[model samples]
Target: MADLLVRGGTVVDGTGAPPTPADVRIRGGVIVEVGPGLAPAGGAERVVEAGGAYVAPGFIEAHTHVDGAMWWNPDLDPLPAYGTTTVVFGNCGMSVAPLRESARGPVLDLFCFLEDLPLSAFQDKVPWTWERWPEYRRAVEGQAVSVNVAGFVGHLTLRTTVMGAEASWGRAATGEEIAEMAALLDESLTHGAIGLSTNVFDKDRYLKPVPTRLAEDAEFEALADVLARHPGATLQLITRFNEPDNIDADVERFARICKPRGIRAQWTAIPSTVREDYLREQTIALHRRLRADGVDFWPNVPHKPLEPFFNFERALTFQRVAAWNHWINGPAETKLATLADPQWRARAREDWDNRVSSSTSRLDRPESLILAISETGHGPLGISLKEYADREGLHISDALATWIGHNGILSCLRGIPDAFDEPVVAGLFAEPHTLTNINDSGAHLQLFCGSGENVYLLTRYVRDTGLLSVEQAVHNLTGKLAGFFGLGDRGVIAPGLAGDLVVFALDEIEVRPEEKRYDNPDGSWRFTRGPAGVRATIVRGVPTVLDAEPTGERPGTMVGLVSPPN
Candidate 1:
């Protein structure tokens, strides 16, 4: 007998096929039938009337930093609400396993620095009861997660575990250390890790390079050999792609690792900007050439502009610049003192001027920074910094600094840029090798909220601009990602597949405005946004989200690269 039946809906099937009226029946968490006019064999236990809605396979988040959030937010709110039934965590070289007792502080420090997680959250919330990857897997598997989680063993954690604090400072590992790291990775893969993730494009909060940036070629080749031994394992990387030759070199290294073993490699943050048209063309062409040579290389492209709401209190964007690094990374008292120092302010002005003249910095245009929320009388609400600075006859940096000094920690500067070139984005989506979702959902929580990108795509692209058909959009979010990540039985709605699905009305879909929520483990505030028009989201035949609300159900399970369903 069927456990649940979704009746009278237009099934899109996540295959880029046209939608058709069909009834889907689920028995014991697997779809038993997907056909028209099929009656429930035993008058099924529960029935969802998906009439006037599109019933499609649940969306898969291709990249995320939910490694810490999973511990505190087992329900994983705002994610399942956005119709993401599965998430790929441990992205960008950060994970929470393979830690020795001595390496715990440095690993957590690295995570807190790179991912912007609060130190108290890890110290207070995470149990810290496990050391090995398998033990960590068991601990996570024992939890009640709301969405399917497929995690990767982070390269930083493995290196730190093998080499101690030296790894944090980017020291080169010896051959013996490399061998130990490979063995640890193998153990992690043996016990349900999906693959390995590393980063070359990130820096710590102190403006130092991450450990993976200093890794030698021999280290990565050894790790790749371990991945090669395990046939379905993948390599997730954050490569240096600002320069064309840098991109080519990174791809060449990845191709050398993946091509011979038929291993798949995925990279992130392929921006949708008109400014880098020539670079985009060269990168896409390189991707094609690599694929033609039989390397399963894929670049994850973002569907939205990389804009975020930031404030001087905990700004992640400005920290990249050398001048602002001291003020941004210092303690509150130190920042306060520096903000008042005339000499320091003068140097900061010079730094801002230099950055403005450079073509590389996104913080160049003062007009792009608008006041979102504030608690001071320095300027009226909704005024751009450039306008305010011009009216007051002050440099933009000085004006911003004065406002922060007066407002303290209560000023929010938001960058709400115009949308990207729609036709170009549509073309990228239509490309065969480009994976379109890299939301970075659970990271940078305080600075921005990108978890809503899935719903944003559905509302803006499919419903509004008509850049993507509903079927194509659904395929990009679901089937293509699942197939790429080897979750073969879950991305499509077919007989014998997992009954993970989303039901939503096309016209009613909308992404809500961002708001602050103090929901993290230590009561630190982070921006959050919700979704509208999603009727229900089911994971493995259970409704994790129903009627636009979480049902408090956690039927989600851990998925591995080559392992069977958990």
Candidate 2:
């Protein structure tokens, strides 16, 4: 007898096959029955009425940084709200393991920019009882996590663990160190991690407190070789050259390096743009080149807007040129002083005015910068920073500073003020080979209103925007994503598949601005209360979140890649 039954919903079914009306029967955490009308099997313990909502395999956050997120957040509600049932973390080569208990403090502080996790919230509060990945995994799994999570062994952890806080990006791994790093990575993978992760050119500087910048070329290659040894292991290459022109050469080199070794390599963060015709062409060339060489690669397309969030500590550093691009993780007073300096400001403005084109980084704040999504309470959700600052009688940087403190974080969702349309983005998505899994979730949490992006995709993109049909978008979110990452039986709604499912009110799905909920493991505060969705989301056939809150069921396991076919 099926343990649970979900009835009366149109199943989008994640396979891109086509949506059809159906009912699903769950038993022993597996989809035991799927048909037109399955009466409750004898002895069915529980029943859920889908109420004619969409019942599909839950979505995947192919890339996310939620290792600490699960712990600090009780409900584990963030991604599930967006229909995300699983996540691949430790992307961009940043992770918590491989560092000693004594060294975890600096590692957490380095990541504090993307997250304002006061030590008290996560570190100080949660007992640092484990030093190894297995130990860490057990501790976390022991808790109630509403979502299923799989992590990669990040190179950042290896370097800092082996070389201490002074780890730099350029230092070549020694013959001895190479083996040591590989051994550590192997251990993590064996313990349940998916693969090895690295960032050739991360957003922050090498010397900054972050771990991405702390490895040499030799070190990365050695890490690659380790991945090669594990057949089904995939590579998530977060590189400096994410643009088309630069992306090709770097991706080509990576493909060449990984192709022969039977490793899959993919670059991140191809943002949406209509005017950048040449850039899209370059991206296609790179994709085609990798495919032609029998190398597996795909883009983690972030068609969504780019809005980073940070606390006063790091927001102040954004004003200075050297500190902005370079690494600047230090005490609070030093950061504030750097921003206040007139000479520093001059250098920063010059750097911004001359480098990293306004096209990609939105550096120049052109006329094209429109009001996308603002954090202002009463005024507007999406407004041009320049115009808003001008009217408010403050510089853009100053307003950002003031707003961040006032709002707990200044959020901006900017767009390509001109010539942007859905069809162009649909074209990017149509390259089904390019597995869609690039939502910068949890990173820009404080600054961006992306918590409801999945809703936006469902309602706006699929239903109204018409970029793709519900089947197509669901494929991008489900099977296509799982296919790229090689999550064998998941992402498809079938008899043998794990029942990680989401039921949502289609039209009601949305991104909403919630009042700041100051609940952090640390005594500090960060913008909380993400857009609520997921009338019901189940992980491994267990109800983890109901009506958008954790139900205290942790059915998630660390996933690993087995050796591939010879």
Clash count (model 1, backbone only): 0
lDDT, model 2, position 320: 28
The best candidate by lDDT is 1
- How high is the CA lDDT of each candidate model? 0.80, 0.65
Cα-based lDDT at residue 256, candidate 2: 66
lDDT of 2 by residue, 188-263 (tens): 7767777877766544333343454545556667778887766567888876553555666667767767776788
lDDT accuracy of residue 411 in candidate 1: 74
lDDT of 1 by residue, 388-444 (tens): 788878887888877777766667777766457677777778877778778778888
TM-score of 1: 0.94
Which stretches of candidate 1 lie above 4 Å from their native place?
41-44, 243-245, 353-361, 562-566
Give the root-mean-square deviation of each candidate in angstroms: 2.4, 4.4
